[model samples]
Target chain A: MAYSDKVLDHYNNPRNVGSFDKSDPRVGTGMVGAPECGDVMKLQVKVNQETGIIEDAKFKTFGCGSAIASSSLATEWLRGKTVDQALEIKNTDIVNELSLPPVKIHCSVLAEDAIKAAITDYKKKQGVLTPEAVAVH
Target chain B: MPPLPRDYYGFFGFDRKLAIDSAALQKRFYELSRQWHPDRFGRKSAEEQEMALEATSILNDGYRTLKDPVKRAEYLLTQDGFPIAEQRGKDVPPELLEEVFELNMMLEEVKSGDESARPQLEQSRQHFLGLREGVDRELLREFQRHDESVEASPTSKQALQEIRGLLNRRRYIENLIRDVERALNPVTPSRPAPG
Candidate 1:
């Protein structure tokens, strides 16, 4: 299927494609995969502890073009946003921005999941108790 | 005809169990083929001929799907309300995902002309193949569990759930193996010239 120009652009020149030290207290790492398609995406965010803002974001995704573009766009949207704002980022937004076809909507969903996972990791590292963490406990 | 017997097992006159006898299934397939062959209904009413055509279609599709163990299990899963394709990443264990991600990175390296990583990629292929074999063995055991339990009972449902997880892992390993093989032999013809 032909990808939208935006997806192609991001895919050809993925932004913030790398990783952060998972062990760093200020860094949150989210690793997600789609076993159906054998796609793995790792997204990370480094937060400014005092400001509660995400100072930087990075990602490495191994999958189709849509998946790469989704994660790349996710990282771009993540930087400069506060943790709360980042949490507000939705899969639908990614889908719309990338103009992903129905079948590729899962790629956007994976990106949104990666974003939430990264924030959760950051929260846990900061000892912030979220309902999800409490539920897990 | 006759609503296509509801499912492949019923079409083949077998119980809803995973332990199918291939010989018997093959015999039944031939019987059904003869019974539904459109040619036999040439002189029948148009409606009967239409019904025969539909039955033949289902018979062919069902036989192909049920003949393979993996495909049979997947079909049963969907019939049992466990849609395999709709399962998400959370269905997979975290450790497995980590290992898959690392392997994918290595594969990318090998594909990008880093010949130094070829040996490691070969090792990874063997490791994944071993994993795939282990999964196959586990599937066989689970199939027994599924076949032994009363249909739709709690035990049967639990067995189906276990089978689904194994199938997911197996598919992931299968994809990795295919990728490794392709990367290892990028230029080799898919079918070597007759030797």
Candidate 2:
């Protein structure tokens, strides 16, 4: 199956593909995986504690091109955005942006899930109370 | 059209338990295959041939899935309408996180053609293989737990949940092993060797 041009671009030149100091109180790391596909994704975010803004974001994904592209797009959208605003970034938006086919839609869902999980971890580190139920795809 | 069996065990006419009689299952599979073989319907009408083809397809799929313990567990979960795939990251044991993280890092090194990482990758492969075997044992216990429960009762929920969790862990470990294998020997397409 051929990937969309955007998907291919992101896969070839994934942005912010690295890790942060996970021990830093300001940085939150979210590690996720899809059991069915054996894909693992780790998304990390450095947050500005006082302002609740995402100062930086990075991801490392072990999966297909679509998964790498989805998470790559996720980190790009995360930087400089407020945590609340980041939550507003939906899987559908990622899916549409990458023109992901029906089977690959779950890759976007995983991306969106990684974002939420990262934020949740950040909130926990900052000692902020968070909702018990975080979305999982 | 008659509705197909909801689970592989039912499809294969076996008892819904993990301790399946492999010899019997194999014999049954061959019998069904012969009955559904397309050649048996060669002189039949087109519609009959189509029906035979569909049945054969399902039969083959059922057999393949039922033959593997892990796949059988996954198939059962799928039949139960449990979003097994979606349960991915959420259901993994929290304690395995650190080990998984380290393994992923090693995988990266291997992927980058770092020969020095081979020993570490080999170690990780053995570790994950051991872990997967442990999970299989747990699955057997859970299977018995479920089988012993009263039929159509809610008491089986705990066993089912445990089985689901074990299956998730097993899947992750299997993937880790595959990664190690791929890195150790990168697959090259088969071609005629140059003289």
Candidate 3:
């Protein structure tokens, strides 16, 4: 299938395709997998300890072009954004940006999930209560 | 020929379970194949010939899916309205995430031509293979459990759901194994740049 120009561009030149030190208390790493397709994605966010801003983001994905593109776009959107703002990023936005076909929509979902998992990890390390935890009260 | 059953097990006249008798399935497949073989319908009416072709197609698809345990589980799961292949839900076991993370790192190293990573990749491959076998055994037991439960009962659904989760884990591990294989043996040789 012909990928959208944006998808192809991201696949060919994926931004921030690397990893950070997971042991660093400032860096939160999220690893997620789509069992259906056996696609694994790891997204990490380096947060500013005091300001709670995400200084940088990196991702590594093992799957199809759409998956690579989704996570690539995710990291680009993550950098310099606060963790709260990053959570606002949605799969639909990624899907629309990549112009992913119906079958490839799950790739965007995985990307969005990776972002949430990463942010959750970051929040957990700081011992700060997350909204979900706050919601339980 | 009457319309073949849509489900693979129904088409093959076998019970939907993980522990299928391979020999019996093979024998039944051959019998059905011969019965539906288009060549036997050479002198039949055009409509009869078309029916035979359709029946043969269904038979071929059923046999292919039913012969493999993994595919068979996936088929049963789809029939149960839990199509894992298309679902975006994160159903993997939480404990596996750590192992998957480390495995991915090793895979990256191997891809980068770090020969030192080969040993760890091999170890991971072996570990995942063992895990796959355990899943297969677990599936067999779960299949029997479901088959014994009253049809359409909550017990049956529970068993089916458990099988779906196992299959999801199996698929992820299978993918990791494939990546390890690819890294261990690089398929494409490096090509010289054009002058």
TM-score (C-alpha, index-matched) for candidate 2: 0.80
Q: What docking tier does model 1 reach?
A: medium
Report how closely model 2 matches the true complex, as a DockQ value: 0.40
TM-score of each: 0.89, 0.80, 0.84
DockQ for model 1?
Answer: 0.79
Off by over 4 Å in 3: A2-5, A131-137, B1-3, B37-43, B187-195
Tens digits of lDDT, candidate 1, B20-137: 8889889999999999888899999999999898888888888898888999999999999998987887876778788888888888898788888899889989999999999999
Candidate 2: regions farther than 4 A off:
A132-137, B1-13, B23-67, B80-88, B94-98, B187-195
Reference-based lDDT, residue A21, model 3: 94
lDDT for each residue of candidate 1 in A5-96, tens digit (9 for 90 to 100): 99999999999999999999999898998989999999999999999999999999999999999999999999999988988899999999
Candidate models: Cα lDDT each:
0.90, 0.83, 0.86
- After superposition on all CA atoms, what RMSD does each candidate show versus the true structure? 2.9, 5.0, 5.6
**Pairs that collide, model 1:** none
Order of models, best DockQ first:
1, 3, 2
| Candidate 1, residue B20: lDDT | 82
Model 2 lDDT tens row, A1-137? 99999999999999999999989999978877777787778899999988989999999998899999999999999999998888889999999999999999889988988888888888778887455425322
Tens-digit per-residue lDDT, B1-195, candidate 2 = 566564567768887765666788899999989988999999999988898888888898988888877787777766665546657466775457657767878888878778788998888888888998998889998888878887445757677777888887887788778777777778864467899
Q: Which ten residues in a row have the lowest lDDT in candidate 1 chain B?
A: B1-10
2 or 3: which has the higher lDDT? 3
How far is B191's C-alpha from truth in model 2 (Å)? 18
Which whole-number lDDT from 0 to 100 does residue A87 have in model 2? Answer: 80
Cα displacement (Å) at residue B128, model 1: 1.2
Backbone clashes in model 2: 0
